[model samples]
Target chain A: MKKERENWVDMAPDALLGYAVVVLALVCFMILLAIVVAGVRILTGMGAA
Target chain B: MWHRLTLEDVKVIGHYLGVLVLVSAIGLVPPLLVAVVFGEWHAASRYLLTSGIFLIAGSGLRFLRVQPGRLSRQQALAITGLAWLVLAFFAAIPLSMSGHYANYVDALFEAVSGLTTTGASVVQDLDHLSYADNMWRFMMHLMGGLGLIVVALSFGLFGKGSASLFTSEGRSEHVVPNVVQTTQFIGRITLAFIALSTTIVTTLCLVKGMEPARAFLQSLWVSISAFATAGFVPMSQNIMYYHSLAIECVLMVVMLLGSINFTLHAEILRGRIKTFFEDTEVRITAVWLIAIVMVFAASLAASRLMSDLPAMERRGLFMVVAAYSTTGFQNVTTSQITGSFASGMLIIAILMAVGGSAGSTAGGIKINRLAILGKSIVATLKETLAPDTARITISYQHIGRRPVTPDIVREATTVLILYGTTYIAGALVGIASGYDASQAIFESVAMASNGGITSGIVVPGMAWHLELFYLLEMWAGRLEFVTLLALMIQLVVSATPSSLAMRLHARRAQRRRS
Candidate 1:
């Protein structure tokens, strides 16, 4: 357990999670942006009808 | 039943507070160096004076120290509650001397806003303000974002009762077993993200033809603000000044990371991707973001507010992220938000009030509490559908499976009620100060959630009473009701005549029993 904990700390955990979160955030943003575009289209189509 | 605070109690609290203040004085040095680098001698003098005051005051309190021991919960609450206000008082000294604010109160407002990581400001002519002053503002953000207690605890400044001090500052989970290691981990992660982001943003700014020196400074400031989930901008135009999609996208990513729970970050660090995704806070935040974005986009479409699709996508996606993260980095102007985006402003208000995850830099009724409350409703429905003696259990995945007991639900509901009450009271105060209902509510939610998105009501020379109340709101909101209420109750109990008489009576009863 001690050795395992040491390896974890030595991995520079900051960079590991920092870069991962950046990618995850971008992916989430893209999906949310698509939802917004679709919602806007549906709303506008209803209004025109 | 409560014991009256004695002189020794005051000294113990003061001793810890003094250490915090003296450590915070180190914050002044970087800004002082910036003032010297830029040849802003006037600002340099003010920084020197404030440093002197902090040292003298800190030493005076340090003299009153008692025997070092573990802190009682009340003492921790008092220290945590008073630290922000006291630091703000010392922080305002330099800003008040900067000649940018209209009065001392305005400077205090700016200091409080910065220290709370609320990002609201009342300084006049921010565009022309000295670089040293801007540095100081973002410094406040970085310090306040990690939390003053967290910073002190990270340095192992408090000899005992560090865990109580940690929780009193509204943080419950420890990423590591030791509170000190947990804080150190938080500091390390923040620095890593800020460094990476500053590099990306600086390159983007240079590609956009900004001067190399100015690009570096602006990038650094924005990176710190975004990673801190703080809203202050070096430029008066806020995020609009960049107008670069890449820069905005980068900031949005950083803001999202900042608003996530630190324990989740640790899980991700340990390669526990499944746990990260399965956490209740993350799941609820994903749902809330999607729902609010869809509603906000529909409102924009119905109102015909930004008829262009690309413009809507850019502003819509960014504003939702900004408001939802409670970062308050605005790309849309206040006029636009108040005028055409009026319907959208209400959506932003809801996002701010609901806020980001618990145990993070972001403030509000956190998504964790909301998740517990949300699960409670489902549990209630399950109970209703079942026959008698149908044993039911409800649990949700945070770090792991945690039962959502009645105590958890009650705790969540109490905080929700407290936030709601404060929002209503603040809005009433705003309306009484002669603003319209929509503006009043929007501004109130913004201040209370530490979402610094303005609606043209918070300005250089606003009403003093309104400004004072907003300052209190930001302070109380950051403390998250419990610690602030504890401090307020302690004050009232100490000061009121009835409480004093009761204390005497209790003392006599103790004597008779003895």
Candidate 2:
């Protein structure tokens, strides 16, 4: 299992770049959304009081 | 020795281009009528003058007595690339004359944007622009989304060059065996959808409290924009100006249908409903859309940006679909999108980069190419894992199930790399011109993929060189790089001293033969 995982990890950079481009974008969006949502909630709570 | 273009090549290209220009002149008539009805005399006269110029130029070109043989692939590519640039120049005339744009370049930018179905506009205060001008802008969308060559062919323009011309316009599949018939079929499908969408949107606009005439016009414009996935809006605020769920829903459906493969539409029209679910491209697009929406929705919910489920669905889901379809329609302002959805901008850019399916109005890397790449990866893994003597085969349904060949994988990878490199190059240009990396990437992908969604970076007076770069990007993106590259190479080769001398010899030979 470990050997197989290592083999997959050693895939060509060109091949990996395509997947990385998509995954990185998705991750960035998710994290940003979380932070934005928290800030919006905090602002709204303060306004309500 | 490399084959060089003769005077015959020049005449042949001229002849076809002249025919296209003549046909394009007819496109001006509708806008003229709109201007007359709306009493916009200034806009009306501009259309008349522009149309007249095109008519004369087209007639002169047709006067070139060129014998017809099928256009070589190189000539077809040159004609296709040259035609868009020429059309953009002519289209810019009326746009610039309207005095709404800062200069000719700004108008040309909008013209290229419209004709490429990119939907990015440099027009300031669109709400105050003349109705005729607005009509002309969306008219470019309608013509360009169908493809200028497809439009010309639909008018019975080509003889033997029809197939090459059709394919050269970035369409990979035909709905029918005959090119003319295929174009006609595409035209019919588009008009039918336009009628249906216009009716639905008109009714929705009426319900949303717009006046009858304005509602109908707005409905027509939005319907055409949505169906082209071209995203031009008559109003400054775009779809958000209406603030109606029903309108957004209708536009969303239109965008999805517009982005679908035209071949699939033909199949469905023939009652092959199973193909929709079975086709690899369609299935992949559906899966991608759903996954993107889920992530987008989660992000929206977590960010508390919209405050409720309905708001999240309306704003979040719609933006995702818009980007995924490569339709630039927005229910939010540019600043709101850039500021509020800052983190999610990368997501939208990625969606834009992936774009819609092949043989559709929408542009991008295309779902078909991505699906092929995915399948290729799996095949590679299977080959690696299996015994040395064992042969593995992979297949997916397009028109029908076909085994994936090495050539198919190579072609798919080449296009993917081209798209990636172009996307990066455009982003680099944006960053060099003083945009932040994220904003640069977002706007670059939007321009390169014909997505038209902006991160507030593109404006009328920002920088001339950047606008020029984007103009080229939109042109290159719309032609899918191959035709443009072929056109460039053909120009370079034809302009060489040896090639020019060879052309002169060919002309002498032709004269002697005659």
Candidate 3:
């Protein structure tokens, strides 16, 4: 998987590489947003119980 | 020892400034066309009048010709510092006549806010404002976010002193060897991003059931605003007017892109994805943002500002991103921000203060400075613990692995101190204008950081003194203090009486002789 990722990074053209970075950033933000939402849910649920 | 501005210096500065004004006059054409297309004859006439004034003033100033050569360091600084104010003055002319502002000062405030990319507004009825006026406002954002000098440099306006003028506007990095090519590359990259983002946003706007024309216009304006990280939305309700999760998410991405350093953009564009990811600014921003977002969420949840998790995810998350980017797009209204979310405002203020990457459109002390300061602390610790004869060297990765020299540390700390002082001084002025402490600090940070987040204190009828102070804060912040200080020092020296100047020169000579 690491090799494949490296290969993809190496092979992509400039425009594609730019868009790929954007996609990676979007995924990261989504994960972070999910964490925040989940953490708040757990905290609020604990408080209510 | 400071030298006063000679006549030659004044003439050269005036001539270049005239060139810049002429460029700014061209900026009016689009808005004028927009007015004409919409059949807003009154607005078009106002634009025509403003453009006519710009032409006359610009041409008149151009007549002050000193043989064209490289701009002196002082000359470059003066032109860069004066350019923003002059453009804003001319830019405000049509806006003041727009009938949406209470007075000329209010229009000028809006113009400064737009040019500084602070996103604050004092226009009375933004929703009812004409297309021409709205276009003008966002055009200011486009010009200001690109740095007025940068835009001029991209057009090959200056010959020899372009580098100094470029740095004078607080831009230090060159993606390309030549200053002109670098500026042009920056422009090309900006337009490409804007084009891509606008297409995506216009699609989302259409999906949200907006009319085709309005959707297109809104998307274009917002694409410029977000990519510039300038916070002005066409609607008065700001981003919340849309309430689409998808639109907000896209804008968030664009805002982050806007605030990322241009060199990183260049790297990405060159397919150096690995280098781009390994960038010190990128890594630091990632960690800082994740940690801050968590803390911001906790603050919101603890305050019971919004009980629902979805609300936390939507409003809380978006505001944190917006604040950190210094983009000033708010999902929450002023009352909610100043009332229920009051405590979280400080976190937002801190985020604005620590802003995004240096050499980007975003303002504030910047992440690069923060990283340097952090390394300085660690280096100090290492030095203290090392043996008496030991020498410690620290390094960090930006574009490459570069040693952390004292000059770098000093530059970072100097800017940090300047930003700190300006924030405090602005807050004091806000307090003197009778605002509460938190409100004053938040507004001051918003102004000084060019964050543009408001807590209801920046209204059309705010005290003239406070309004003027905010304008100065925005101006100083956008110039990043050093250029502003250079301008100020030169102004003071020029204004000194000739006898006093002579006496000072004599005293210096006498001291030398002794």
Highest TM-score: which candidate? 1
Best by DockQ: 1
Q: Candidate 1: what lDDT?
A: 0.88
What share of the reference contacts is kept in model 1?
0.21
Q: Grade the docking of candidate 2.
A: incorrect
Alpha-carbon deviation at B414 in model 1, angstroms: 1.1
| TM-score for all models, in order of appearance | 0.95, 0.89, 0.94
lDDT string for model 1 (B1-514, tens) is 6545667878888988898899899889989999999899999999999999999988887888589788999999998998989999999999999989999999999998998888988989999999999999989999999999998888888867899999998898999998988998899889988999999999999999999878988899999999888899999898999989999988988898899899988877876777877888887888788788778877777656564566677888889989988889999999999998998999999999989999889988899998898889998999999998998899999888999899989989988998999999999999999999999999999999998889988999899999999999999899888899998888777878998898789999999999
Model-by-model DockQ, in order: 0.33, 0.02, 0.28
lDDT of each: 0.88, 0.84, 0.88
The digit string of per-residue lDDT tens for model 3 on B346-449 reads 99999999899988899999999989899999989988999989999988887789999999999999999999999999999988888899999999999999
Clashing pairs in 1: none
If both were scored by DockQ, which would come out higher, candidate 1 or candidate 3? 1
Per-residue lDDT for B4-90 in model 2, tens only? 566788888888888888999878998999999989998899999999999999999989887767788878988899999998998
Cα displacement (Å) at residue B388, model 3: 1.8
Candidate 2, superposed: residue stretches over 4 Å from native = A1-49, B1-3, B497-514
Instruction: Report the CA-based lDDT of candidate 2 relative to the real structure.
Output: 0.84
Ranking by DockQ: 1, 3, 2
